[model samples]
Structures are given as structure tokens and as C-alpha cells.
Target: MSIFKTKSFWLATGMTLACSVAGVLLAKLPYVNLIGALVLALLLGIAMQVFPQQVRQTAQPGMAFISNKFLRLGIILLGFRLNLVTLARAGVKTILVAIIGVAGTICLTYWLSKKFGAEDELATLTACGCGICGAAAVMGVSPQIETNDEERKRENEVLAVAVVCVMGTVFTLLEIGLKPVLGLSAPQFGIVAGGSLHEIAHAVAAGGAFGESSLDNALIMKLSRVLLLAPVALIIGYWYQRKFVRRSVAQHQPTPKKLPIPWFLAGFILTSVLGTFLPLSAVVLDSFVQAAYIFLGMAMAALGISVNFRVIFQRGGAVFGAATISSACLLTYMVMMAKWFF
Candidate 1:
């Protein structure tokens, strides 16, 4: 049956659209904007569980479409948000800081989360979210994980997103509040916020407190980390494949065949390259950017509906602690790097 002709598809799509609009509006309000539109949409998605059982049963296919198909599409569109030219303008020193910060945060967060008794999938997801672009990074790397249990996979994804949201918001506010005490110049402060924070939105909120130069440099610095997402995801995919192969051989089990690299991720990289080099008009670029936001909003909303709150409550404490420790360390590291490099 045609997806468009299915009543359930429209019902589910309509729910997502309604949630997206509400989330965007809520994000624009004072104080609430700190939570951001994506997070707001996620919260609304979680609330979808309260609807009638018949509605949920019928909506399953459409919801799955948004979660899987829209998610990849959103990630590809997200590449348009990155401009190699702007990232280059941020200077070599700032770029190096971003690179080191991402690497360090990932290693530290993953190791610590594992030590705290997190499963491999949970630890890796949280680490990626912290090291790169929060929920987007988590979602991007998720498909690479070699998990037989689909429920467990979705649970970890939700937990990782929640951890990053909480951690990112905490650091965002701290950066804003510490601006007076730090006494750093605008660009330096921007570097610290962009290099340290989890999400682009977090960096914007924190860096924009300083001024225009701060906001611009902060975005470029954030994009430096964003640009690394493609490479990091590829590395994770390769790592997982090798690890799974080794496990299969040890157990004398047949190795499962999977793509060495996710096709969607390759598309992401290609889109980024084209967006960077193409002579696209401002209007066209802006439209693409808007589309990206809507797609991402819907994707996040779909993921939110799949969240297992029971699992989160059961395993959250240790993982949250791991994320908190990693965030604190990354923030300090960025501060030192910013002071030295700037």
C-alpha cells in the first residue's frame, strides 16, 4: 500500500508535525528556549505513549518510517549546515583544540562509563554524543552498532540523548555564568564554549552571551567538531565490524555480513562537500537549512516515542555520573586550550 494513502501514516505524520510546531514555539519562549526545539519535540514524542492503544498500534509503521528513514535524511541534510570555509577561517589553533577535545572526551567518557558498569552500547553512545554533536551524533553512530536486540538498541539511544541533553544544558548555563569570572576575550570565550559544549545550540546560547565575534567564532569552532562527525562515525563503524568479527570467530559462529560503512553516512559526507564547494544562493542554502531542522525535529520526536523510561530509571545513575565527569573534564580542558591558544 502507498504510504501516503495509509490513514495511519497520516495520523502519525500529523502527530509529529503538531509536536514539531509546539516544540518550536516553546523553544522561542523565555527560559524554556534553554531546552531547545529538538529536546522539546522529544519530550512531546514521549508523551505520545499516552494516546489510545488502537492509535499507537496503527501508527507503528508510520512512526517507524520517521524514526529510520527521516533520521537518515535529516543527517544528510545536516551536512548543509557545515561550511569548510568558515571552519578554516577559525584558524589552525582553534581547529586543533576542537580535534583534541573531541578525541579526549570520547575516550574519557567511554572508559569511565564502562568502569561505571554501563553496557558497551550505552557507553559508546553516550561518549559519541558528548564528543560530537549530542543527539545527532548518538543517532548517527547507532546504526553501526552490532546489536541483536532491537529494544536494547533503542533504549541506549534514548538514554544517550537524555544524558547529553542534561549535561549540555548544565554546561551551557555554566559557560554563560562564568563569562564574568573567566575574563577572557570574546573569541577566546567562544572557542571554549564551542569546543567544550555538546550541541551547536548549547554553544550558541553560551557564546552569544559575549557578542557577535563570539557567536561567529563559536559556530565555526562548533562546526570544526561537526565536520569530524563523518570521520568519527566511519571509524566507529570499522571498529565495530572488526570487533564483531573477532567475537564471531572466537565463538565459532558465522560472521554476519554488514556494510563496512553506512550508506547514509557516505551521503552525509558527500552533501557536506557539495554544500561547501557549490555556488548555491543564500536563499537556497537557507531553505535547505530550514528543511534540515524540520526533518531532525521529526526524527527526534519519533525516537522519543520509543524511549523506555523504566530502563532509564534502572541504569541512569551510573551513566549520568560518567557523562557528568566527562563533561566537567572536557570543559576544563577547553578552558586551558582556549587560554593558551587564543
Candidate 2:
């Protein structure tokens, strides 16, 4: 029987659901949740190989849309967990470090991508995703760029997800190992991990590995980093449009109208601000946000399964190099700021 049959569909769906549940449950554990989620995500990726074609086709369009849309919405809801006033109390230095880390990561990654022989579009997507907020960053910029080839677009998506998974896992393991070995303070570890991890979830996991205080600090730092997404997207969009115009003029083709900014990003910012003033119950809001995040994770896992694992491994050195250099620079910057300012 073809793997695309009903059994395969149900099996894949079940596995995804299981992975999501495991991720959330693990997240609640004292120190193990982050590593658990990373392991589970990887296992799900490997299990996805059983029905390769089905997983790829399933992950293509719907998974992409679900991962992008709900993840943004989730980030908006996550704002409720934050106390803007408290963040302000943490002072401007914390904010400055976050801004520098985000900007530095993007610039460094772009330079590293060129050195690694990555395509421009892929490099841009990878850098933004790594620099700002993972998958959401990629989604925000996708509409602005014209990726006419579906295959190339798929390749971009795969690269983004693969990097996030690998880097997120490494961050978690590092947090787990370093917290005990170095006897680092919660705030110090939080600053280091939040600055380095590729995704917010990974930051949370790393923070949790250190304890509640570290988790709270790390989440705040990570959110501050996330706030950079809008400005970064705007700058990238502007630069992309400028390049497009130059190319069009050089080729004697009519320049297209500029693409509208992603409305969801604006909504995310607005909701975050509103969350500060709203009287909503934390239980209800937290539950909703948690659900959204779990769904986003499953969608990402499904997306991961779609990648050609062999191809990714073949190009592993370059990918690892880019991620390592970018993360290292960001981490170093954050640590220096934390020492100087905090």
C-alpha cells in the first residue's frame, strides 16, 4: 500500500501530536524539559523518514502557513507573560544589549553566509531567522522577496528549520552542562543562553535548566530581543526593495510596487503593548499561548521531516560554521554587556 494512504496520514498525525504533548510536558519539568523537547523534536524528525514522501507533501504548504501564522500570534499572546514595567525596571542597559545582540547577529551572519557560499536569498532568510526570532522572521520577509522557484523556496525553509533545531538543541545541552559545571549565577546564565539560542523556546528551555529565576530573566531578555524584529524587518525590506529596483533598472524591466509590510507583525507589537494594560486572567491567556506554541512546534517538526537529511548532513560543516560563528559573536556581546551594565 502507498504510504499516502489513510494509515500513513493518521500515523504521522499521531506522531506529531505525541511530540507536541511531550514537548509541553517536558517543559514543565524542573530541568529536563528543554532537553526533552529538543530530543523529541529530533526523534520526530527521524521518525518522519518512514513515510518520506508523505511527510514532505504534508509539510509543504499547510505546515508553512500554520507554523508562520500561529507562531506570530503565539508571540503576541506571550507578551502577557511579560511585565513591561518590570522590564523597564531592569533598565535601559538590558534593552541596549538586546538590540546590539540582534543587530550584530544579523550583520555577522550575512557576512558568514557569503563566506560559506550560501545563496543570497537563503542567506538572508537564515540570518534573519537566526538573528531576530527564528521561523517568524523568515515568514515576515518571505512576502517581500520574490522567490519564483518553488524548489528553492523549499530549500530555504528546510535550511531555516534545520538550523533552528540543531542550534536550539545545542543551546539546551550547553545550558544543562554549563549551569552545573561552571556554577554560574542564574542571571549570568540567562543572559548567555538568551543571547545565543536561535528560538524563544530554546531560550526558555535553557533558562529552565538553570532554575526559575534564570528562566524568567532569560525569557525577558529573549522578548527584548524579539522586539527588534520589527525594525530589523523594515530595514531588510527597504534594502531588498532597493536592490530589486537596481536590478530592474539594469535589466530594463518595470519595477513592481512595494510589498505591504506584514500586518501580523504590526498586530504582534500592538497586542504586546495592549497586554501590558489588559486585565485578562493569566490562566486563560497562558493556556491559549501554550497551546499555540505547541501547535507551532508540531508544525515545525513536520516541516523538519520534509527536509532531505542526507543533503543537510552533507553540507553540515558550512551550516554549523555559520551558526556557530553567529551565535558565538552574539553570546560574547551579551556577556560583556551583562557584566558591564547588569
The whole-model lDDT of each prediction reads 0.85, 0.67
**Candidate 2 on 1-342: residue-level lDDT in tens?**
543455545555565566667766766676555444534554565566676576557545544454455445554554455566767876787788878788888888878987898778777777887787666566555555565675556557667556756776776686567666655678878877777777777788778766888887887787777777777777777788888888999999998687557566676667666766777677766775676556555655655555555665555456557877887677667666656665
lDDT of 1 at 56: 78
Candidate 1: count the clashes. 0
Screening candidate 1 with a backbone cut-off below 3 angstroms (N, C-alpha, C), the clashing residue pairs are: none
C-alpha RMSD values across all candidates = 1.6, 4.7
lDDT of 1 by residue, 181-288 (tens): 987899989988888888778888888888998988788888899888888888899899989989999999998697567788888878878788999877887778
TM per prediction:
0.95, 0.80
Give the poorly placed runs of model 2, Cα more than 4 Å off: 1-32, 35-49, 52-82, 139-141, 175-184, 305-310
Report the poorest 10 consecutive residues by lDDT, candidate 1. 302-311
Scored by lDDT, model 2 comes in at 0.67
Any idea what lDDT model 1 has? Answer: 0.85
Candidate with maximal TM-score: 1
RMSD of 2: 4.7
